[model samples]
Target chain A: MKKVTQILSLMMAIFFLVSSMGNAQSKNKVRKMEYNSKYNYEVATIAVGVDGTKLVKVWGYGPKPEEAIRHAKELAIACAIFRGFPPASNGAAAKTPPIVTDDSVIEKYAEFFDNFFAPGGKYLQYVNLSTDAPPTGEDRVKVNKKTYKVGVVLSIAFDELRKDLEKEGIARRLDAGF
Target chain B: MKTLVNFIFIIALALNSFGQAKKPTIMVVPSDRLCISKGFSQTFDNQGTQETLPDYKKALQNDGDLRLVISKMSGMMADRGFPLKDLEQELKNLAQEAAESNMMTSSSSGSAISESPIDILKRTAKADIIMDLDFEIKRQGPNKYIVFTLNGLDAYTSKNVASASGAGQPSSAATPEILLEEAVLSYMDEFNGRLMTHFQDMFTNGREVKVMIKTFANAGISLEDDYDISGNTDMLSMHIEDWMANNTQGGRFNLSDGTANFMRFEQVRIATEIERNGKMRAQDTRMFVNELSKYLRTNCQIESKVYLRGLGEAWLIVGEK
Candidate 1:
């Protein structure tokens, strides 16, 4: 009976330790993926909204469809601020220059951006899914056994975003005369 | 305590003055290619050469599409806080001035002075930047689309400062104007960004302008004439160069060409404003040349006449007004 109790206590300790370790590992993975998605993603201007917004299609990767979709929003805003859309063939789409022209600005304003792009953070205010339905099979693809890639169309209030950046002293205002 | 208050007040005044900096005035015009392609150009004799120029008056009167396009672009720019000089309004003003001038002929010769439409526009508008627009509508079966291009050219230098071009999505029911509006909306931000960057660069490097120094045929003085100032004797041209070096922002300017009677300074970067009477005043090529004229009068005992061609080029003819 004593041996069984000791074994049961050891098993409980082991279970708790394993669960906490798994949680730490998952947290680390999320941080790493966030950093990767911030720098690496594909974004294209799908359409422009009449009310000073931009509809961009961005591809984001994660371990699940829901996670990928969340990353897609973050990537969409990041691309709009840093990597602008390329000119399309036959003049199909206009070339949009990035809001932040300086390449080193991300690193310089890392703290501000980190807080801005955090989960359920200020970046959510600028962007939303273009459609009411969730992404379908084609839009959500399994890139590997452990990773899923999702394409999302997000409408970003680009002008408002630019104004906010200018207000935050990250970007210069067009009317800020010499 | 009174002295400290005065010091604080002076600091506040200076800060307030700095906030009143000027912005470049913008005017929208049809591109030369658009005018020529749309049969809105006229042939003119220029010093024995046949030259073609855009007939802006004809274009404005005949083309409804052009009017809509210009209105859309100007409205968009105005919304962005840029000051715009309306082309159509300026044209009317020109016509009124022409009629008035025709009635008031010269009393001695009974002849009236005439100016070309382009010249009148330039003199009246004096825009620092010209936004040249070009566009074409394309059709694919029942669907219609528009391809558009906008070029921001420096009015003074005629250099392309910013440009945006693209095609709008094909639509079955959208008008050409709507298609153009869509295309411009997508590209205007980038184009405006480039424009603002260029303007900010002017703040750092100064505004680019041209200056030419000439001597009157009967005037005894030449650019090569030596002038003595503060125990330093130098040619008038050298003195002018030294003044330009001292007064120009960052001492930036180019002596593109020089002769005994003619000296042309291209890429003369002049300050946008200067301090006078303990206050800041706006400056242009005219104001800049006026300063040079004053300098010559005060230091070299030389009288000069300043002639300005629009806002960018100035001629300082020594020994005569």
Candidate 2:
């Protein structure tokens, strides 16, 4: 009975020590301490045309600073592509009648359009708009204990993006010049 | 075979119509401030203090001038697929809810009573926009003229989306109703045009959402710094800015205010879920903030606490981890 009690006490001490070590590690963790923002992008408009150059901004979250930066850069490119090919309808269906005379045709090509409008399409040729200058980093925000948020800004040539879409037959070009 | 073909054609048209989303709901209310200023309200002594308020009940019952205008406007909106929310029905529901809640939460000692906040009225109405109507009649020589103004405001944000004011030619009409209608009819197209323009902008840009970024003073991190988490060196601010640009519809967002410790983003289009009257409706605003929180959690291992105010505003605190 005495031996059993001594062994139980020894086990309790080891368990307590391990638990305290875990607590200490959490308490002493070196976190990224990133800023939490409500807005998506910062404003830096350098007008080159009537519509102005689209400044595609994106945020990247990663366990490391580099990962977040890389992710943000990728997001900026994706945003530019998506912005270039926004939804055809802006909820004006009530005022304007449906353009698709045959619903079945739209239904058939719906999947193709969905895939076509994604980040990278086979028809799209990307011209590096970031050629004007290298990407500018904005903030380093530390999220929980492990993650960090980094912001990157890229100047996407909206004119070029529009021209590419029209050339690819994805969009119809208007006669009115910008 | 002809009948079957007709049936299939009808089905196709029905399906196509169903694919379109419902139009936004609008509620029209007489502006209390305008009514008071124009001497259209009632004044009474409350606790020996004189108080004046819009006599909408009396106006609706006895005055046909505004009533005719509302009826005509509502008819036009309904024809355009925009549904009108009844102010009387909304008030009735509010009163019923208040009575039921009061009965349920009655204390044993009868000392504690719960008071409902003013915001509950907005939620119960469930209107996407509120159209405030104001009008004034002026007498010039032997003729009387009416001038009217309509202000369209977003229900959640209380931001004016559209506004227009116009006056009608002086008429010898005996009643205010006929004269007011004539005045409103002259500029109805212009007023409707402004409203449609605002709605189209909102539909294209996405509903406006206010985003605020706050940093803890003790976080030991500045907004403009190279963060080295996971062996990556990048300016954290730029990454956040990029995320905002990517998520918003048409990349439409405005960074109205930014500092090392605080950042305010206006017109951020984030799809959000709003809980109203015990039912969660798919709206947008909270979703944007949630997306930011999720990105931080997944990428930076940073945990964020989100505090949502109403439907269009969100506050996020960082560096708490």
Q: Which structure among the candidates has the greatest TM-score?
A: 1
Q: Tell me the TM-score of chain B in each candidate.
A: 0.84, 0.68
DockQ for each numbered candidate: 0.42, 0.01
Candidate 1 wrong stretches, greater than 4 Å = A1-38, A102-115, B1-10, B18-20, B44-51, B97-125, B139-144, B166-174
lDDT of 1 by residue, B75-129 (tens): 7677667757888788788778767866877889988777667555555645778
Give per-model TM-scores: 0.81, 0.48
lDDT by residue (A6-123, candidate 1, tens digit) is 9999999999999999998898688577648546767777777676788788887789888888888988888878977665444556777778877787888999999999999999
- Return the top candidate by DockQ: 1
What is candidate 2's lDDT per residue for A4-110, written digit by digit as tens?
99999999999999999998776545322222231232223221221223444446777787666555554444344332212112110111111122235335566
Off by over 4 Å in 2: A1-178, B1-23, B38-64, B105-126, B155-160, B203-205, B214-239, B259-262, B269-283, B305-321
Candidate 1 positional error at A43, Å? 0.3
Deviation of model 2 at B209, angstroms: 3.6
Q: What is the DockQ (computed on Cα atoms) for candidate 2?
A: 0.01
Candidate 2 lDDT over B199-224, as tens digits, reads 55555556677888777777765666
